[model samples]
Target: MAKFKYIDHGQGGAPACMTLAEREWEQPAGRQVLIQVAYAGINRPDCLQRAGAYPPPPGASPYLGLEVAGRIVAIGPDVRGRKVGDEVCALTPGGGYAEYALADERHCLPVPKGMDLLAAACVPENYFTVWTNVFDRARLAKGEKFLVHGGSSGIGLTAIQLAHAFGAEVWTTVGNEEKAQACRKAGADHVILYKEQDFEDAIKAGTGKQGVDVILDMVGGDYINRNIRSLAVNGRLVQIAFLQGSKAQIDATPIMVKRLNFTGSTLRPRSDEDKGLIAQALAEKVVPLMEQGKCLPVIHKVFPLAEAAQAHALMESSQHIGKIALKVQE
Candidate 1:
């Protein structure tokens, strides 16, 4: 029997909880494909789960990863177009830390040409997120102004590059000058040092007091209303995470006056159908960009699968410029 290595959970900090262990995995069931995982992407939610701050979705695995790239080794009867020996990158509910994992067939996407498993592993979470929030939720149109918080983060960096390639004028907020420069190189039209200046003021000045047409925010707290103030008439605000506390004292006057729209979503709980729609859209719209070298994940570092805790630590330091991934194969 082939054995699988997985990140087992205990209690306390990342290293303690992110312990690696050997296990025997069950066969894939309905529409599920068994993947011999080559690489897995480390996400902030994984760290939160390790810290006991976030919980796995009901009925999902308790392991600590969401996205992976690998080869299909087995498939349930209902799975299609995915066969043994096929290479794919996928969005999973959990369990991606394992050497062998299962994924919904619809959620699996072909690894783009010229991209290896490590680079492809970084795509699903951030790519699916940015595609849904920026294009579907915010409906960001070409030539419009877009502002994203935490620009140097995985999701933010993906959003910036995608928005830029699609003809949007992208603006972003970052903590330091180095991150600001990184944002600029990633195609942001303007970079705001959120620590040195109020982003709302900077946005106002940058847009000649007109403000951005769309705002993608992960930092909540005072950012809730500040996001409102930063929008132009009919602007849309798409919130994905609350890195800061979600609570806030907000004045709704600006929202009402500007006719702004506020919406947010978490990807993990969505039905397979919803994510499948996003996958199809990305295949048609974004994969070509990857093939053309116009868009790709900026990998900051790669860690062995056993060192997931250390990877989480690096992500927490906010020192990495873009994505952090795990090399699960060797």
Candidate 2:
């Protein structure tokens, strides 16, 4: 057996728990492909996993990292549609922090034409997540009003660009003026400085009290009720994370009266078939936009693979305006 270097977060604690370590490499099996990773994306879930909050699903790799962009060096007997030397950015089940990683062929998307591997590495997690939650689940249509919280995040920026590209009125909430500018440049129609104004109130006033048609939210704590209140009569609210906390006490009367739908999902635990469907959708609809430069991943910073701990620390600090990545090879 061969060996490879990876970040190990033994027993899981803080960002400092992650360290460069070695493990024996395993051959790709079934539909998996062995990637000589060039870069791996850093996401909020990665930080949560490192802090012992999120755990990998059954049969998934235990290491941190959920997305990577690299070349297929080997393929399993069952693999199809991908071959050795194909350049792809993949949504990995786990272990993306390694010099080598295994990804299901179905979860891989070609690096968009004219895009670098570093930018491609930032795509899988945020794009797959936004595609599923905002489009597939929330059904955001052209001319509809959409609001996403955490406007400066990779997920937030992805949502802003996609919704705008699809002809929706995009709104977002950010922590400061710089983040507000980033969101605006990403195609946001309105940017609310959460530190200075109330998001629910802003939405109400901005839309003439009609509220938004769809809301993609990650701030769960008290924002749950505010999200509910910010929806139009037949609106949908998609909750993807709980940055503040999950539990909330809210009025249920509005849900009944307004006929609003509240739903959400995490990408990692989804079935492979479901993920494949999303990948197909992205390749068909979103990839063209990438090729046209209409919407693309916004990378904020990159760190060497050994500095994954520093990457996580930067993520948890919430200072970055877009995606962070780790350079795994060269």
Candidate 3:
């Protein structure tokens, strides 16, 4: 078998390393399909995997890619609705960053026509995260105000476009003025420069002091409290990650006083069946938005498979304005 070197972390706090002289192993038995990876998206979870904090579950591949887009080369027995030569993207619990990866049929999504593999690779993680947390969990509605932190990020940009396309008012917080502008260009109704202005104040001013109907937050800790205060009546705040440390001294009084609903989730920890449901939702709802060009994936850069370290460095700098992709094959 031809081997494809991948980026991985061994165990406990070690820096990410690449192993090139490795051989591709045979696929395991399951209702799965082997994909000849064309592109893989680099995500924050991948960074966690590289730091040895995140690992694939038992019975899953140890390789560290959560989403990939490519062509199907082989299918397991009893698989249906797909076949060899299909261009598709799917969520993976592990083993995404390689020449080939296995995907359960239920989680596979047909790539939209005319979409490049790199852009398709960028969609699954961000789209699934945004849709599940923002729409499915929070029940965001049309004409409601939706706010997202890290507005120019992979998740934030996806949320902005999807919410706007669904007739909701979209607002976001970005690190700099340039990113704020990029968020606006991506159909955000308003952009807050967290550097120059307090996001709470920006949100208040933007909504005439009514606050937002929903907020998608990845930065936890102190922002947890502020996120609640930033909500409208019956508002929902979905916490996705804690880039600023999870623990913090916060006042939860606002939750009762404002009657806000707080929720959050991690996609990689979810069961395959649940992920399949999210994928089905994406196929029915979000894919049409992509086909109409309303909520397409925005890629910042594409790095070759070998330079995975450099990709992590760029993401660490918090400088990227959209999704970063890895080109797995020429």
Best by TM-score: 2
Q: What is the TM-score of each candidate against the true structure?
A: 0.98, 0.99, 0.95
Give all candidate RMSDs, comma-separated. 1.1, 0.6, 1.6
Which tens-of-lDDT digit does each residue in 145-188 have in candidate 1?
99999999999899999999999999999999989888898999
Backbone clashes in each candidate structure, one number apiece?
0, 0, 0
Question: Relative to the unseen true structure, what is the C-alpha lDDT of residue 63 in candidate 3, on a scale of 0 to 100?
Answer: 74
Per-residue alpha-carbon lDDT of candidate 3 for residues 293-330, written as tens digits (9 for 90 to 100) = 66888889998887777787788778998988889994
lDDT of 2 by residue, 183-211 (tens): 99999999999889999899999999999
List lDDT for all candidates, in order: 0.91, 0.95, 0.85
Point out where model 1 deviates above 4 Å: none
Comparing 2 with 3 on TM-score, the higher-scoring candidate is: 2
Return the top candidate by lDDT: 2
Worst 10 residues of 2 by lDDT: 48-57
For model 1, where is the 10-residue window of minimal lDDT?
9-18
* Residue 218, model 1: Cα distance from true site in angstroms: 1.0
